[model samples]
Target: MNPHTLHAPRAPGDIRQHPTGAARLGPELLLAVAAERLRAARPELAARADLTTPQGLLDARAALTADEEGDPAGSPLVVAVIGRFDLPRWVAETCRFALALPREPAATWRRAFTRTVFLAGRPDNLTERFTFDHMAEDGSTAWAGPAPQETTTALRRLLKTLDASRELSAWSPVTVEVPGAPPEGAARPPVHRDLCIATARVTVSQLLVQVNHLLVEAVLDQLIAPGDRLTLRAVPRLTGPAVPFAALRVDADPRRAHQLRAYAGLTEEI
Candidate 1:
């Protein structure tokens, strides 16, 4: 709890959990984890300055990526982890992907979507034991196929409501259904069949961004640090704010509790 202890090391704490069970991890927790992995990924910066806020995490990740890519260091990285993340499977995958990475983050504005996800399943129900088969050879993205129609519809609706309510700018250009592309003089199938929805799904993902905005990076930097490495399982909190750390267990896996315990190299009793 002291200020100078910013860079000090401590035992990894549980990152997810709440009274309601399967609840979403506190927004602060996400910022914390991102900070820890990101700082560790770039030890040079982690050793200095308190990046315990979401902005701090963003700044730290941006700095590291810029340093690696040979771009100017003064400015922040203008990148984002843009994709559909509200699906149950995606929710699990997003957390797992970023945390397990051995390299710097791909973007500075990384926002993991979970509106649809939270609407769909119990957050705690999401677990590390749920193995994600690799979809890409590089492993940057997961190989999860489309979820069941019920799941898909829920996501679609969630996205629509969030989008319409937010009235976010048309950052994305989307093509609905074209009227008549069949008869007249179409040499081939309509080349421009439908327009791509310009970040519609993405724009509506403010739920996550807003969630983290509360904690920012100041708190996050404390939870996650360079030397500390954690995975997807949720754990009980040893200390810190009620939330951000609440609803988030360090490792939130129930079925694989034994597997996780072994992996962390921790005994039941400490």
Candidate 2:
């Protein structure tokens, strides 16, 4: 299926009105504001030549206006700066909570955990529509069957893992109980559940990040014109003041994709 077909249509007058009037700044000034915000967010990183100094600003302006791709100047891109959330941390915490349960086998618990993370609060039919991977001892992998049960039970269990009443906006820290090491000279070794959980955490985190990147790419390539607007809202559960993560005026430059990939903190070549 064409991925573009999945995006919801943007409503009329959907553009966000910034109280500071920053949104109305010319592209050059807006990019400067965005760079300043990035610098403030990540003070330790070495400053980028395209973002930090006066000469850098001038160079960026020159590059933007060069119109190397021969596309006409269109509507100005309006990006909404949303504060960052620690999604990987949350995923790890949730996985720890699920893995600690003694009632189910690790595989069953993981299946339930995956469904709760990705499919909870959605249609039940979606569970059967999506397939997950199952690895074999011989290093082969095959498509796994749908989750054995509905996510309702798992969702309830996972929700209890965090206390939402104390502070609704922040992620509540979970206390994971680490299994003790096996006694010395034991005949059997300890179950490798910790390693399995660690692997699951990494897999889930990468998938979530890639899903986010795909959404951004779709918006850049298909949903909006060069001068149109895009706003990323903050994750509601993250505790912090909203801030611009990164901002760039969409243009015909081939490097635009790389800028976004960098903003996403993705290391792989796009």
Q: Pick the candidate with the highest lDDT.
A: 1
Candidate 2, position 227, lDDT: 21
Predicted structure 1, TM vs. truth:
0.26
Shift in Å, residue 179, candidate 1: 40
Steric collisions counted per model: 40, 2
Worst 10 residues of 1 by lDDT: 261-270
| TM per candidate | 0.26, 0.19
Stretches of candidate 1 exceeding 4 Å from the true structure: 1-13, 16-20, 71-200, 203-270
lDDT of 1 by residue, 134-153 (tens): 22222323322112223233
Question: Which tens-of-lDDT digit does each residue in 123-222 have in candidate 2?
Answer: 2222354333321222221122223333233333432221112221322323222223334674443221100011111233333333332333332322
Clashing pairs in 2: 75-227, 76-227
Write down the lDDT of every candidate, Cα atoms only.
Answer: 0.29, 0.27
